[model samples]
Target: MKLISSCWIVDPSTFEDHVALLSSARALKFEQHCPLEVIILSGFNELQLDYVEELKALNVNLNDCTDITRELFLEYRHLMQDINDYEFLCFIRWIVISRFLVNEDYVHIDADLHMQINSSDFLKLFKGLTGTFGSPCLVAEHGGDWFQAYCHYFTMLINDKSGLLQLLGDTEISLIRTNIVSDQDLINSLEKNNRLPTLLSSFNLENWSVFINPLWPYITKPSSPVGFSQNGPIDLIGGKPVLFWHLQNDFVSFLGRYYLLVDLLGSLGDEDLVVKIPKLPIPYLQMDCSLANIIFRTLDGLYRHSRSGSSRDRHKTYDPLSRLSVTQRFIHSHKGREVFSERLWWENSVFLPLNDLT
Candidate 1:
């Protein structure tokens, strides 16, 4: 069995620190558990063998796939012109897995993330889900579903080898007009038709009753006694390494970015904890790409979220302890009625260790 990191880069995107950052993530992945390999699922182009070798020589692994041939490149170019990032992500993600027969439990990390904990430990985050585990329960991140995530964070545990093969097999060769979200996410209609595939179950993931804040270490059980007595879960608070550090769209998209999950490598000590949100891409594009716009956008969002009293709320987070002598699991052993709150969790600055997994 092998753990593989598969990624594709558009032809024109500059290689600022993207390669270096992902390489660090790969290194962390190896440090946590079994030694892993990086599978570069790139467009098979002619020539540039020497350049490819140069990258290999520096210890960055490579594998070639012709998924991005002349035929597909044109479609990608058209998407870029129309500014369809969502659809592009979907097409690229499914394609790589399809080309590679990833039978073993492999974790997929988006290229932009920098690892704080051993990347391999991330495998534990989504270990058992068979990908086809029915409807996954989702946390209403922005309080409600006003602006929710179409997909979960980048580091996903994909158990099924045929994850989304049926839906994506027949991609059309036409321009994606009107809305990019509709063309890419494909969820609005899937939900309407009642034909969405057997996606991962959401209830299982949210089974932890008490969040043993590694940072706080205290088990913050259900807010109310009735909830605890009624129904929840029973899980232990064992010591585990923080999973991964994600940097989304400049500002720390995940609340965990605010605090560092110090316990990344189990008992190895808190050596790789990174607190504080990553400022911005050092430089978005080398050749006059709009770096200023990206930075401004993040700042603008943070400011808006703060002013509206909706940006500052965040989910409960934890810090990793340096060592652990016992294993812990949570048990939400109660059945309670769902209640609607007048105010929603509007903040995003969660107190997560820089190392904790997203």
Candidate 2:
């Protein structure tokens, strides 16, 4: 199977895209040992040479999608007047995928995803599944009475690219042009009308437990352990290990915390500043310094903002300082909404005791 990630680098500041593509490729090649082709679609000319070299070092097949992206923007620019380049790429990616990998079995993970588990072992669980499979985005209640379900494109297993293209063809594009909806919104509409051929799968395992005790705003503790085992970074769901974390909108913040933690550890000399959580293999930063306080406070702010109100409300109240963690934040933010789990925080956090935070 081929593992694909698509990113259109219109801005050089979008470092999370590079991190996502590189880290996932590394995970697939080094950690999972999965015999799958890793393909990346991005504007190669726009990417940094060092970043491109790192991907090449990992044996990633980089496909330059600049020409295709330009053509797509030219044709759809008028219809996509309100949409930005990033959002526009979301719709264009499917067209690119359909044309590029026809009749091929592939998993198209969003560029913001961070993968940990073995691909072969994870894909084995979906052996009997037919047609295309996507992670469950929004449930019936949140989407209204007429809504069936919406599948997130974050982690999609495309066994039938042709069938998927049918859903994204001229008719659907025309509908999108009329309504001016997001790719996910259009997908939800198709799902509501029973037009999608794909199955909505909860691949994220959002309700499943993580080893850490559930932090507030979030009530339940599902039992998945996440930490650096002697083998490497380990994350589990339903007592079974799985593949990838879709950090979604929290990726930039998560990456920021990671780099900040790295810098803090370096500055603190890593001797007495690190502490270990019980039953977890990795050491965490001690919550004593000003920097540590900043981390936790930012985390708390994220929880508050996410739990505040509706999607639009959350967007309006989005705290730039509050976007630091992914695992706990992702779980809590979607508490009453969609279920999308991610462990990027566990991979990068300073491991604060949840009970200690107010």
Candidate 3:
């Protein structure tokens, strides 16, 4: 069968088993349905520890990789290796090169995302796009700058991959020194070379169409099909996303934004009680469950219900089948509420478009 346009890249750290478990779950789910290839460029630590064998059983092909290129502070000997790793996804243009095998357009989902999407549904979306999955396109969204978008966009599609190559410019070799000592050095070099996203505005919406699709990797909310958004969640030809970003560390900065949204949604309370996301699962990448609570009552609002002051009657929603009875009822009550997307990254693969979100 011809390959589909979907692939994933994940850096699995050993300490972050939850993240690994999530990534493995994703690889398992996607490999079965999407007919797409998934690539994992993670460290050897996970492999040396035997967790990778479990991961391998999930149909993942592990490429030995490092979080930081060089270990010691001495001279940067692995700078080239480091640069190669940094520019890892730059190869979206060539679909034939993947070991996962494919002849169509694709998306690279981060391991952190916890989507409830059926991989088959996404495959259908690509079938409509009519390009090889790995093909590139330019997409516009409400985020920092093109570079950041470019990273995710690289997995999505627009027009011609070659066109994208020309527009984004070729990857610079000197730019990637394998012997690089620190992540900072690699980041600084790229930022200086203008290879990274421009900091002028994280909100700078572009029209040029970098890599298409995967607009927001973790977020399920939709961007209009026509062009740049003048509004929010305005569904177009495809459908509005039920998903949202589930970022971990950034929570400290995002709390007030959600509060503002809550107040706005509550003010409009009628049928739409402002949705409340449940407490987000701790990001295993940054924190272990030992220190990280399985559930945080903070503003992350992942599994949390969105409560609108306007709606006198509580709305129905869904929680994992794992919850207790009272918790189950509580989970069912928060429908139509918006959840923060940044917190529940890993769940995207297994729990996309929760039956409730649908």
The predicted structure with the larger lDDT, 2 or 3, is 2
TM-score of 3: 0.33
Q: Write the per-residue lDDT of candidate 1 for residues 251-349, one digit (tens) a residue.
A: 222122221111222233644322222232222231244765455455444543443443343211121110100001010111110110111112122
> In model 2, which residue pairs have backbone atoms overlapping below 3 Å?
209-222, 209-223, 209-224, 210-224, 211-224
Provide the clashing-pair count of each candidate structure: 43, 5, 73
Q: Best candidate, TM-score-wise?
A: 2
Tens-place lDDT per residue, model 2, 1-358, is 4555565654655443334455555545433244333333455676678877677677565677667667767776565566776666766666665556665545555544444555565555444332233222211111111122222331221233345445544444342254434666556445444555443443333533222112211113324422321122444433334344455443334433443443345555774322321121112333346665666566656555655688666544423323323332332222111111232233323222333221
The local lDDT score (0 to 100) that residue 295 gets in candidate 2 is: 63
Off by over 4 Å in 3: 1-37, 42-50, 56-105, 128-358
- Using TM-score as the measure, what is the rank order of every candidate, best first? 2, 1, 3
lDDT sort, best first: 2, 3, 1
* Span of 10 residues, lowest total lDDT, candidate 1: 322-331
Task: Report the number of backbone clashes for model 3.
Answer: 73
